[model samples]
Structure formats: structure tokens, C-alpha cells
Target: MSAFMTKTLKALGLAAVAATLAVSAPAMASGGAAHPHAPKEGFSFEGPFGTFDQGQLQRGYKVFREVCSNCHSATLLSFRNLGQKGGPFYDEKYKNPNDNPYVKQIASEFEVPDIDTDTGDAITRPASTSDHFPKKFANEYAARASNGGALPPDLSVITKARHGGARYIYSLLTGFKNPPKGLHVAEGQHYNPYMAGALATQWSGDPHHVPVGGVLAMAPPLKDDLVTYDDGTKATTHQMAADVAAFLEWAGDPHATLRKKTGVAVLIYLLLFAGLTYAAYRKVWHGKH
Candidate 1:
């Protein structure tokens, strides 16, 4: 072949490679956009990665409050109750460990509340809304009792006051299934299609069909032998689900305590802006007539 022809063919090959890269770039960047089982930050649940281990939750909380909190607010959580059951928002458990300064700082900031058994009241002053997050469940029975068969969700801030919110959150959490057998999952990553690519576990057909992992992820976090409660109540998978769901529900709705204040502030701002706009309009037209 002539040198000119060879150069032309090389250019064409380069263009083809570029085109192919462009087509695959978005897919590579977004591993799990098409599937429902994608894990999103703050929204995804880590299941096969592991169930709701209290110790793990503590670490997760550290990750959330330290890293994720800059963009996302757990406005549903209170600053006071971080150490208690609902979330690992506190760090006292690792006070003795010299390696965990993050845990030590969180634990040092506040005191944990003890519950009163005799009258069924909090033995200590409740953590004020500004202090930290509240316990997800006052107890297991309490967690189950809230939802009318559906688990009562916490709304410290993020709940579906409008359309599609609940479904979006639910789908992201439970969407991880078995990636087609023997698929490799990277460390610190959970299996999810909505966030990851199509693993062997995700099959086509019915979107509503539960993935191979389980039906609704909200169902089982605590199973027999999974978690041990101090109160002697078996921390069954259902109970863990109920507890974490309740805790998340609380995290999503923490602003309930300040809803009135926020509403009033918004009302005042709107009224003032409206008045200013009206006055400005009148001034502009005042010279017309």
C-alpha cells in the first residue's frame, strides 16, 4: 500500500476507536444506571456486603457525618442521640482504641441516654434536636408498632412528601442481587445494578420481580443469631429491618421538630418578597398614569 493510503487507514482506525470509546464511556462511568438495583449514596443499603451490624453502622455514620454530610444533611437526626441504637452516629464504643480518633471525638461530645424501665420513660433528659440523632427504635416492639403493617419510616428530612420519593429510595436499597454466578465484586462496594452494571444476578423481564437476593430489602436485616439485643429481645432480621428502616425514617424526617420554624421563616420571606415586588411594580407604573 502507498504511504498516503496507510496514513488514511490509520486515521480511520483512530476515529473508529474514538467513536467506540465515546459510546462506552458513559456506561463505564455509570456502572448501574439502567437497573433498579443500584446503590446511591445515602439511599442505598449494603446487604450482601453485610447486614445492619451495629458496629458497622458506627463506621457508616462516621463516613456519613464526616464525608457525606457536607452535601447531604441528616436533618432528620438530632445531635444528641448519636450513640444510641438507631444509628452509629456516636463513637464511645471505641474510646479505648487509640487508632480511632474519629470515634473518640464523637463519643466525647455527648452523653448517652438511659431508658427508664419502671415508667417507660427516658431516664435522662432527651437529646435536644440540635444535639444528635435519636435512637431508631425506642425498642423492637416500638419499631414494629409504628407502621400500619408498613414499617414506620423516619423523616428527619428525606421522605416522599411528593411523588416518586418513596419508590426511588426503596428500589435503590434492595436492588442488589447475585451477580451472575462467580462475578467479582470489588472491595468496599456493594452489589447493585441501579448503580453498577448488569451483573449475572439481574435478569430482564419483570422490573417488579425480586432479584435473586430477596424481595424487599426492607424486610430482613436482623435474622436469628444476627444481632443480640441487650433487652433479651431476639434481634431477628425482621426486627433489624424494622429498626434501621425506622431509624432512616427518622433521619429522613428529623426536621419535624423544626418544621414549624422553617415554615414560618419561608412564609415571612415569601410575603416580604411579594410586597417588594408589588411596590416595585407600582413605582414603575406610577409615572405611566
Candidate 2:
């Protein structure tokens, strides 16, 4: 092949590679932009030495019960889990949550549906410690039907389910806002920068209607001083979001304390073993070299 032709081919290949990268650059940027609003906040249970603030967890549970529970369900959690060791309402004297009065009281507040054996008819009974958290709707279809075709997601393990976990939850809870000018939010859909749904509308007329991020089905459920904190911590929206995020993190990983403890113990053991091994090696090789 001629040198000139070879050089031309090489130039074309380089141009093609550059063009490919250029085309993909916006996609990569857009993917990152999707989560640009998720602010990473510090949590009490974040580091190795971290632990859940019992008071915060209790406050968060209150928020969840009053607000989020109206739609979402924590199916993996039971009333008893609330009063278990390392939990918010744990009682040292009543390690078994069944014996915990607080647990029983919380359980009794909810009525579980059941079928009567003799009557063969559905009946509602007070919830027990063993009963899982009840769903607000009977099923998915019912949930969607009630909420204008938007299904409220089950919050069991939600902290683990999302990409950024607790921080993401906190951000999302506090991130709801009006869409920028020229952006069209559809009817029944609320604007949330951190959620994953988009509003439906033709974008030809509006300059800013360029496929913005997803719309939240649920309205902004939190507000300033929404829940009166028993501890007198100012009930700011940020505070509530943080507390609820922490509580959900615990709900998703109830054994986080034990896991961290075991991890610390193992690390200590490994360090001691390493030191002892080095000492023995020095003793064995002393004066030999």
C-alpha cells in the first residue's frame, strides 16, 4: 500500500475513535446527572464505631408510622422487631418482644384481617407481635387504582434497594421542588429531582422540556415541624429526613451492630496474631543472621 494512503487510513481510524467517544460522552454525563441531586449526608451509624441513635430511630419510626405508612409497607418487619435489642423501643428486662408491653401496644394499634373459623367470614383482629407490618392497600392493583395508576413501592429493605441507600433516601425526601420554567409536569405527577420517573408531555414547544428526570407519584409528605419530636430536637424537614433515613437503614439491616462488632473482633484478632507471629519469628531467628 502507498504511504500516503496508509496515513490517510490511520487518520480516518483516529477520527472514527474520537467521534465514537464524543457521541458517548453526553450519555455518560447524563447518567451521572441522573443522581446529581443526591446529597451525601453524615449519619450516626456510618463509620465502624458508629451506632444508631435510639431517640432518632424512635422519632423516625413515628414519622414513618404517621406519614409513609399511609402508602408504603415494611413487609419484612414485624411489631416485635421494634422492641428487640438494639432497636428503638428495646427494653432490657423484656428481651423477648412478645413480653414487651410497648411492642404489644404498638401491635394492638393495627388491626389484622383474618377469617373466622366457624363463621367462615373475613374479620379484623388486633395485630400481634408476630404479625408483619400491614399493607395500606390489599394488593398492587388496589394500590395503583387508588393512586391514579402510580404504585407506592414497598419500603422493606428500601435502604438497600436504592443505588445510594440512606443518603439517597434522605436526598429524595427533601428534594421535591417545582420544575424549572418551561418544563412541563403532567397532571397527578409531582416533580422530584431524585426520583426516577419523567413527566409526560410533547417537548417540541418548550425550550426546557428536554426529557427531565422522573416525576414522583407521591407528594412531598414531609414539612417543617411535621412531627413533634419528643426529644425537643427542632423538627426541621432535614432533621426528619435524616432520622427517617437512619431508621430505614436499620430496618434494612437490623444486624448492623452485630456485624460491626464481629468485624472489629476479627480485625483485633488478626492484628494480635500478626504481632505474635512476628515476635516468634524474631525469637526463632535471633543471632542467626
lDDT winner: 2
Please, what are the lDDT tens digits per residue for candidate 2 over residues 1-289? 3365456556655654564454222112132225532234567776665788899899999889988898898989988989988888999999697899998999999988999999999999999999998888999999999888989888879977776677778878888888766666778777766665534462445554455556767888899988888889998888888888889989998888777777667656655665575577668877786
Worst 10 residues of 2 by lDDT: 24-33
Off by over 4 Å in 2: 1-41, 197-212, 285-289
lDDT by residue for model 1 (1-289), tens: 3365456556655654564454222212233343232223332222211123454344334334443333233434554444333344434554333324443455455444767888888675533434454445555466566532334444454433412233333344444455444445443335554442454453544555433322222321223445455445554443333344434433554332244345446555655665575576667777674
Q: Count clashing residue pairs per candidate.
A: 42, 3
Error of 2 at 81 (Å): 0.9
- lDDT scores of the candidates, listed in order: 0.42, 0.77
What are the root-mean-square deviations of the candidates from the true structure over C-alphas?
20.2, 12.0
